[model samples]
Target: MYAFVSVSHPDEIKDRKRQGKLRQHAIRNGIQRSKADRAKKDGVFVPVEMEGKTTVATKRPTNTVALTKAPSVSLMDPFDTLCGCPERLRSLMRHPSAKQAGEPIFCVEDSGKPFFQGMETIFRGALTDPSLFHALSLVLSLAANNNLPNVEILQHRGEILNGIRVNIKGLKGAPQVSTLTAMLLLIGYEYRIDGADCNTISMHIQGVQTMMKLCKERNVALIDEVQRALFWQDLLSCLMAGTPRFLSHRDFSDFKNPIGIDQSQQWQVPKGLEESMMHWPPECAIVLEDLNALCWIVDSECNPDQEVLETFPIDNTQANLESRLMDLLRECRNNPAEPDPWYEACILAAYICTYKLSTGIWMGCYIPEICIGQIFQVIAKIPVDAQYKPAPALLQWVLFVCGGMTERKNIRQQVATLIRERYPDPTQDPEQEWETLRTTLKSFIWCERTMEKRIFIFWNEVYPELHTVDSSRNKMLVV
Candidate 1:
């Protein structure tokens, strides 16, 4: 079941063509320079003046292309051709169908709809750009062929990295939105494909954040629907890494709310405890948004001042959220009738995030083991179709959280089985694949051990597996 249910329509070709013409007109009138033109002028050519003579100087070329009347023939690496060089990738990306397709190649698991609105805009622009397309295509290929053998995976990984380096080295002066998108894709590749080190991913996140700020300063509106989705994903990554987020609430201010319960006054729950439990307040989305925003503030780059801390006391905030959650759960229990499992699952997911935020701020002082177990139980009761329908991205994160927190052997096995069933890898052994995923989750948690000295010390006692010198050590599986 996809977490989000909103379907996206393809952008009108004429509209994009009109925008392209207007942009060209602006460039002709000196309103802006084409990114390619700017790239060419920016340090690509150096003027040399000697004895009143001027000559254009060029650096050693990465590849050779004969200058002739006929189409220049460039000799390139075989791997480059096989992997889809930037130019070739760009052409493929700009195909009219690419815009119509809406979804990025790497996000195929999220078929039937674009992850969010404004993705068309980002994809449309990305397809026509060489560097961005190369990065985007690399990520897409990785996601599509995740089950490839280790040898093939390594080969592809190397080629993609080289392609990124060659293209990015050519980008000079100010960073463009396309460049930022490319960087975001690279980070996604590291997280999803490579199982990259936390420090490496953190550095890339920081780089993207810097690029975003640069775009804003230049009046470049880069944060569209696609970017908002990426930003949210990165925020989740930050939480796992125990690092502050680069993209904050202000960056995604224009983001649309995820689909949820009806907020209209005309919408009402039936008059029974079981019925009410099966329904969520329209305000549920608002509360989730608030929780996300509060999480951003709590994990902001700067430490919270004493005054700020006092105003939004972590303990009180968590208690209130938990209380509200319990009230809803209690209503269902009192009625002796089962609530809609799906609705109950959604509430449990929301609480998981709420608790996660609190744990991050307080260094896991309040373990939500009970809530975590409830999430698994409710999820187990939910139909497979329902689990994937509402919002896949959100659902994925919630499942990741559930996987991370649970120590119960049966629950861990269940989570692993569910993941394999949902996202099968035909090339890999299912058991081994799920075990690797579990290890990855534990590694992520282990990396965050230094968020607070006391917390680290406390976790060392509670989670003895953390005592190992190798920070990459995985926690012991709970029997």
Candidate 2:
């Protein structure tokens, strides 16, 4: 069943938009150079002079401050004393749709793992643009109203806003504005704040408009390069299970074209799973096996239940596609560039495991458990002699599957065996190494892209309803 029964709608909270708008107004009025156009180079920050006050004279400006280098930064500055955004944010808190005393909310603790925490580093470092900041501010404000801001917020506000009037708090470097804005932009405006408003359709549209207004007022791009990056991040989070750390820095590349399948597909599957299969769970292996079986059944006389393909009953499927996807990987094992056409067909068949039986649900139960044993097994079983070259795509699939799964000892062994079996020497042709590297990279990218697709569908379509249903049932049980 879907999980979001008790989830509150943000819009359901009375005047949340009004509160948010007011705060946005306050931010517009209070913030200096909210626009990227006004941003000074990192080293060039002059004290924002007040009308009558002098720059707080501390020790002479250190000559050592690297003017050419970016300024030192924090992900979430707990030292900020500025409470400028809180009052307006608190106004949003009073919204009836905001979290009530017993309503269910996203598990902040579940999200607190260090792997997730690293996202802050990505925010502070690679993602220092205005769209990101606006997104961050919006999410944080929502977070503030839903639950108490982490104690860190209070501590930082105390420090940053020290001796300053409450009204002027948002002016000084408000990290929340930067951090949360990035997150919202990353997750995008489509996500509904649980418990806010249940009836309004197209939360993404509302979110985008709200975010765009903030961006326009601040003169940030509603959709820009950084926005694309943030979108990618959000997509990855939604589809792929576990923390962000498993997703590496090299995974994101400006040069790579994002897989441009339908937005619906984007919602359904994550990218880069061609390489991520290493992390799949044992259950995924079973699912992958089933998918291989399904392909066999489709080609043969077995009359499988048509409903097994339906997306909604995924968790209850007789031959869970997720398990089949894992088995497909195991069967695909690492062969070099040359294998028989039938073997190639076997590899292509593996992708079907990712497909829904009927409509459009991406059952990815195999990704987290995928390891090298299965991957190598597929390769070792498929024979390769001089007469036949494996489907070129097989290498890509191998790398992609490995990327999603975790690294087990078997994976390393398979890698070694595949390389030795395929290109036995360091002196192997330069062209071949290049091909290998390129294929590997492609697989990894595909894995990441697949992950992104899955996340969007889960959060936007699945989780909200599921959580609501779950919450409703729980409440009923309690009563």
Candidate 3:
């Protein structure tokens, strides 16, 4: 991935508040020197000396050092390369005219444009450029379809599970592409072109899903791509607010009347804690990094006393229960936070749970009491759909947990089960239920992990080395 490091001039340090006064003191001493020069004559300091000798007066050292304010030149080319940018773009980053000699460096370009304009421009360019767009799409598709292992699938097959590992080596040399939207388009193209191989298409889809998920997780914006167009800030808000449990007790009375605490108290919470609570229900508060922002939003939009406090206790309990249940849907599948709006919207759908049979805690721990009644009324209408159907993985997880294949309610359970048709005979030894289950799940996970690692290692590491060796002979012959 392309990244940047910020650079600043050393002279800017002197003007900092802690050092500004010292700098001024030094300047004043220079003024004193100038004053002493005026007292001398003919550009030389001469003094009448004893015994009829004349001598020049000692002069203080100059305080002035050469200072040049120039636009950063070293970084210009690399930045240009990253954007697929031409020379003209440099004008956009340069100062319009020279100014006072001592100001800290800044992009003198007009502030009328947004900070992300450069990113947007490059994205647009990538969309129009075929080669760049194709590479980006492939990268995104790969990111979307990543699936880690589950325990049950392995144990059923007499296998063990290992942890998942990312092939960073392959990622490093992958084709370069610009713009999130372009990447998605390219991924779609790959799927269309591959034809007939459902597995290959599925893999491409996963990649795209991963890319979009990462973008959402990172809070990056997809300004205007048709494939993914969510703004980063909006995605985060959705992630925080869409939980049924968090929304269960939410005040529907209008933005002015919030469900939790009075507006004033909301400001007291830390930001990182509030954000961390995004994955948690409303009752549990976490210490967060952006406490100040949390305070601002709560004070401005939320009013707890008018909402939750006024509700009946039984109603509040029901609402709390429903929220917990809904939150479970968000975890049912692995979705990366990426800039793709569709993937984000899909993840957001966890709040609108009607398709499957779920109870209060399984939904969301913090869903408002009122919404539960609302959702409870219309759950029959939601349709069940799983793109790239991860039934196999799901099956594995269920088997690992339950210890065998069984159905609980409408949900499928995949645990290893120990069954007794009748009372056990006195002569029979008791079955080792827990250890067998653990061993089985462990084996299942290990097998899946092994395959995934093999694919990644060979493609990312082994293949590259082999390719390098193969190319060496050809290069020598050409030379």
Top lDDT model: 1
lDDT (0 to 1) per candidate:
0.46, 0.35, 0.29
Candidate 2 per-residue C-alpha lDDT over 1-479 given as tens digits, one digit per residue, 9 for 90 to 100? 11222326766545666567666767775565455445646346654434446555554455544457542342233333333343343343344422211111111222221112223344333323333323333444444554344454344334322322231235443223333333333342223232322222233323433454455466543234333334333332222221122222233343122121122321311233322334334444333444433333333432333343331233223223332332333333333453343333333335423332322221222223232333444455655553444344555445334432222335434444554455334443444543454454443223222232232222222113333322322221000
The true-versus-predicted C-alpha distance at residue 63 of model 3, in Å, is 68
lDDT of 1 by residue, 193-240 (tens): 334467778887777666655666666664554356456446444423
Best by TM-score: 1
Off by over 4 Å in 3: 1-118, 131-174, 179-181, 185-202, 205-328, 332-378, 381-479
Per-prediction TM-score to the true structure, in the order listed: 0.35, 0.23, 0.19
lDDT of 3: 0.29
Ranking by TM-score: 1, 2, 3
Compared with the true structure, what per-residue lDDT tens digits does model 3 show for residues 6-95? 338677565566375666677888888888878665345444334435544355444434486555555434333432333333333332
Q: By TM-score, how accurate is candidate 2?
A: 0.23
Poorest stretch of ten by lDDT in candidate 2 = 99-108
Looking at model 2, residue 159 earns an lDDT score of: 36
Instruction: Give stretches of model 2 more than 4 Å off.
Output: 1-210, 221-225, 234-479
